[model samples]
Target: MKFLAITLIVHTPHPATGVVQSTTERFREVLDNAVLAEELGFDGFGVGERHEWPFLSSAPPVVLSHIAALTSRIRLFTAVTTLSLLDPVRAYEDYATLDHLSGGRLELIIGKGNGAAQRELFRVTPEDQWARNAESYEVFRRIWREDKVSAVTRFRPGLKDAEVWPRPLQRPVRVWHGSATSKESVELAARYGDPLFSANVTHPIEPYAELIRHYRERWRHYGHDPARITVGAGTAGVYVARTSQEAVAAYRPVFEGNLALQKSLGLEPVFTTLDDFVERSSALVGSPQQVIDKVHRYHEQFGHTVLHLHADAGGLTRTRHHDSLTLFQSEVAPVLRRDIPDPPFPWGPVLHAPAPAATPLAR
Candidate 1:
């Protein structure tokens, strides 16, 4: 299985203390984490987009552009770009530019964003988000794949015989629909035959598994080859250690604290305890064997080819975060790649060596 390290730059102050890192420091930490992810042999590094307090990832393209200049090999991805809230023309321009700067290492996962704050920021209502998202994505796809496009849409301005400049470096940039609760996203992905990446962060695996099944069914319904369909899944958390007991003991405090915050915010408390999270939710916190088994179980359920994990949450220390990434990369990741089925997407595009000038790490 291809592994991606998703960086959700969250802010809830330090768990040990009520103090919060400065905004500048927080941004630096995120950049540092991306650089470290590349050094650790992570297949992909993804950043999320959120326009709200307690999250620092509103400008995914800009951040990813900086990362692209810094790193040479690791693929850069957006966990979910809020397609519902942006002008497709501008989004296309920014991402296409980024694709060029990254030497064609950019991938996108589009979604109808959640959170009331985002809707307020974009002046979009919940009722119109799905429609807007569909319309925006349709325009965005055409803008990327087609040379000249003319479209009249609600959210996007009309283009009359005008061509978007600096077309993406890739012929057609790869896009994966970020499916969580919306069947619209699933159906849209199916109709277009694009890959679907399930947001398996909040709830248990059953709902997400069902959504994946529906995606594949609809993919086949659209006369697309089922074998051509690709699926990527996110996990609630991942922290590997030498033993399950130690993993639980170390991760329990962070898990419990995160749960408390969720409850306070009136969000659904899916898995209330660490044990419950490990047993039911997709949080893979345990020993190497235990982590391997959890992933195998998820593969059996959803048949995911790309697996993204969040190893740092609730403000875990840098040391702990590095340790988790090291253990997983050294022990668990290799096991999954050996045992899991080959990913539907060609690894050549992602894993291919870059040109000498594009490869800056040697410098």
Candidate 2:
């Protein structure tokens, strides 16, 4: 099994204490955590993209490029680059450059994205988002796989044998489609034989499990080999301790603070209480063994070889949060490693140097 420490770089006053760090401090915190994620032996570290308030992750490529300089082995990921709001050509240029700068250690997860403010800012309506995302991905994929691409695109200007600069370091980087209860995303991923990463954070396991099932079903329908299907999943949060009581007790305040923040933002809280969140949602708040058991239960349905835990402390003190992650690395990961099968492909990039000029990616 592979694990990632991912952050959306949420920038807000402390939910518990109402204390806020300056923008510089928040960015440094993300960089420091990326380095620590490498030291803690996580397989990957992901930075998310958002164009809304309370989130400082609008430029994932810039953040990841800095992280690339700070760490050597940990693969850098765009937790879910919101392609619907971006120009595919520009996005490709940025990430391809990042791939080279990172020594070919880059992976991407693309999504339609959420948030009303961002949708308005991009002028991408809910009805238009999925189509825009699909269109953008089609263009982005072609630019990555071909030296010169020609396409009549709707959202973006048409391309006519356009040559995108500085071909990526990876012969072909792995791209995961981020699906949050969207059949369009599942079908798109299946049609292209790419992996699917489920946003398993919002609701109960059943909805997410059903989405995975749909993805596999469509994978087969698309005539892709079932044996080659790969999947990854996300958790809402994680905080492990020596005992379940201690774990829950410590996380309860954090949960309450988040709930309060949600209400203040005029968003409905999914799991009204901490107990419900732990029991129903994908949040892992328990002893190491208990967390292991919960993951196993999800794996039974998800068959996901990769999983991600939140990198931020949320409202918990930095010391407490780091200790919890340390415990996870020490006691939980090894057991899961022995139990779950590894991902079908290597987590890192395949090649480290420039591809042949004008060469299209090979299957």
Candidate 3:
């Protein structure tokens, strides 16, 4: 299995302390984490796009460009580029430029983004967002696969033999549809035979699992090779310690504090307590073995070959944060890599050589 460390660059105050980092400091922290993820041998690092308060990840291409300069090997990803809010041609040009800068190591996970703020900021309504997402993706993919394109689009101006400059370096970059609580994204992925990445952080496994099943069914309907379908999943959070007790003790407050944040946002949370969150939600907070077991349980449902963990420190102290992730890399990650079958998307146009899972000291 391939592992990725991704952050939305949330700029919220510390859940427990109410302390917020300056925007500059927070951005630097993101850059530093990208470097650390590469150093720790993560397969990829992803920056998310969120155009709302308490989220500084409004421009993923700019963030990923800086990350490309810092890491030589780890692939770069957009957690879920808000294609619904972007002009497909402009988006294509930006990512195509990034592909060259990253030496053909850029992959995208596209979606119709969520949030009331998206409507306010981008003037895209929920009623129309999915349609915009689908149309934009169609044009975006065409830009990558074809030299010039002519098409009529409702959301954007018509294109006629338009050549998007600085053609992509990857022959064609890989795109993974980001599915959350919808069949539209799944259907789109299946229609194109592209991979699907589940935003599995919210709610329970059943909803996301149902989406994957739909994806597989549609893939067969579309006459794509079943063996070529790829899926990636995200955990709500991850923290490991020597024992479950220690891990729970460390993460409980963070969980409760975030639950409070959820209430403050006026959205009812599905997992109300730490126990429930650990038991049902996709958070991986426990001893190394317990975390591994939970992943296996999720795998039984998700069949995900790529797994992403929260990249930020969240509410943990720097020491605990670094140690927990390092321990996971040294202990938990190798086991999954050994046991899980490899998915096809990781082998891009320019295949990267596998690196040691972790440094000798970490092992």
Give per-candidate clash totals. 0, 0, 0
lDDT string, candidate 1, 21-55, tens digits = 89888778778878888898888899999998768
Off by over 4 Å in 3: 350-363
lDDT of each: 0.84, 0.91, 0.88
User: Which of the numbered candidates is closest to the native, going by highest lDDT?
Assistant: 2
lDDT of 2: 0.91
Which candidate leads in TM-score? 2
For model 2, residues 285-316, the per-residue Cα lDDT tens digits are: 99999999999999999999999999999888
TM-score of each: 0.94, 0.96, 0.95
For model 1, the superposed segments whose C-alpha errors exceed 4 Å read 311-313, 348-363
lDDT of 3 by residue, 107-163 (tens): 999999989986779899989999999889888877777676777778998887788
Scored by lDDT, model 3 comes in at 0.88
Model 2 residue 361 distance off true place after TM-score fit, in angstroms = 17
Which run of 10 residues does model 1 get worst, by summed lDDT? Answer: 354-363
Q: Model 2: residues >4 Å from true position, as ranges?
A: 352-363
Per-residue lDDT, model 2, residue 322, is 94
